[model samples]
Target: MIRKANLQLLIDREYGIGKHGAKAEFARRLGKQADYISRCLYPAEKKGGKNVGEDFAREIEREFSLPVYAMDQQRLGSDTAKTIDVEGLPAPLAQKIAGYRQVVEVPRYDVAGSMGPGTEPPEMNMVVENMSLDANWVRNNLTYTKIDNLKLISGRGDSMAPTIRSGDAVLVDSGINTVEDDAIYFFLMRGKLQIKRIQRGLDGLTIISDNGQYPPIEVPGEREEDITVLAQIIYWWTGRSF
Candidate 1:
């Protein structure tokens, strides 16, 4: 039998039960009842109820981007002792599963760029630090192919309130320097780095703030190069607030 501790570790590491209502969020993603998932994580000792079964284990492997064999070992125990080859699976799926086993380090800049009203953007000195993120999370969340080009920077200002709050850390894909319609981007405007939603117009590009308090800014289509696009904001997380 698979030890309960191993299963609990997987839940705590991946689902993060107490953090951000992760248990409920994971349940919703897995399309399973929350109570049932809770039971699977903490099975009853007296009644000897069924633990997480192979069906649910496979579902978790597929949905959560985990190795099926690892979960199988923890759920089915000796039955899954023999090494299973992943070569039989489709090439793309196999490659993704293989990538999940690795970790990637992303560079985090020292400066915090404004998202709302602010002065000129500060210069990016050397990278202040590096953060190790799961390769699976990076590949699944970001559309960019070159993972090395990804950078992390902090956003300052309430102009983008409600959606992206002040002091939030955003992941910027430096490879995507082009402005896509209605897409949020981190760019340099008048030497100041700012993040805003861009909308292409007949005459120019419209820069918008999520907060209604701030009015939009317009740039002539011919002078688009003046506004140097640094990167497109892919993902962001609350900094100190969390």
Candidate 2:
């Protein structure tokens, strides 16, 4: 689902404070009317206020020259090591995209997928920075189930300290939304965000914290629906010069 918050973030980045006629400028940039922009961002309680649809997201990417489905991604670039079909593009364009199979630009968003004792997660997939890595390197280094689903985000809290210190970053496979293995998972529980090791048992799942100070949170098979597994924590770092 394309979150309306993401679109609002894009507009804010392009036209924040000091940008005179921000709304109109943003609308013009998207080839939309100022009134339409207002309608999209208008409060839900307001009449004629509608959430922006998938089509609008496509238009945004097309207008900004972003990759296809860029707006829909919660994270970016991973080496699927699979072939990328560039069959329908113009000769030169196809050749350019074909080269992309070797390397890809990965996004790092400003939001954090809280490690424990949570905080609210960003509703939008806003890209603040991007890093490029070889497809082979990603495929070899990161354990992932889906290609083009890994995006980097910061981590907070010490519930998973040592394993994932505060201010650290993690590359999450946003595509994997299940307890495939007894590994670390980035998930949502009771409307809050958490990143912890989840042990899957016949009964259900166990949310664990590496720090002995914090106790485990259990999700019995009956209450498994209470937690939403957003992704699996594939790789992590201290966000330093290491």
Candidate 3:
């Protein structure tokens, strides 16, 4: 996932003009023969691919004239590239690594007639689109339950250590903004998703970290542009043997 993100950014930085370059490059990378790359961005087309899927990587290499590769998720920081020849990658691998599509059972509510006491909990099938990473769920899906499609993303940095040790997975809630006093959350600041706690101050929102070694991230009125509440962390799962 990280490799795919880095790949996207790398491509964007190369051909995207005023941030529009990524879209253009994505179209080119996908082999769009027409000039639809410059079209409006509201077409609801799910474009691009992520790691564990090498086909898209090969396409990017061919389109951008760059060496595109996917690294192992477990040892993401290393130089290991499980190379697959551009012509040998199977199409099913792309579909599988792209995430699996599942139907979520939603209750069908009656709106046309009077309310009844013995209401049947009709199972309405709702398609949950497969996302690149489970983290993408926070942005793509709408929440219905407190634990709706929530996922535990392994901590990357040392800012939230001990309570959430580096490489430990932290359970995050995508439903409600239950910003408690010291709970950790997946925050979005400057187009990046980070883990931090919300500390309310007299003047602004201060992003507090568990390890006091680092100072609190204060978002004063002047610095309001710095902090944005993407989602709050309801639970933290730590110390898994695997």
Could you estimate the TM-score for every candidate?
Answer: 0.62, 0.58, 0.37
Q: Using lDDT, rank the candidates from best to worst.
A: 2, 1, 3
lDDT of 1 by residue, 1-242 (tens): 35344455455456432245666766778887766666666546645344877676677767756666566564324224454467989998888666543446789988676876654765545798997665555665567748888898888899888778887888888888887757888988877888888888889899999989999989988889888888888778764431
The models' CA-based lDDT, in order, is 0.72, 0.75, 0.47
Weakest 10 consecutive residues, lDDT, candidate 1?
74-83
- The digit string of per-residue lDDT tens for model 3 on 1-242 reads 45444454444345431243456556765766324433322133545422324665465556656543432232232234343443545788865554433222222212111011112222542333322232233234433344344544445666666666655544455554544455556665664557766776678677766777878767776776665554555444355442
lDDT of 2 at 22: 74
Better of 2 and 3 by TM-score: 2
User: Cα RMSD (Å) per model?
Assistant: 8.4, 15.0, 18.3
Off by over 4 Å in 1: 1-20, 23-101, 239-242
TM-score winner: 1
lDDT of 2 by residue, 1-242 (tens): 24465566556445542234778988888778898887888777779986778798788878867677766654321223357688987999889777665555678888786776787877786999986555666666667766688888888998898789888868888899888688998888878888899999988888899999999988889999898998888777654331
TM-score, model 1 to reference: 0.62
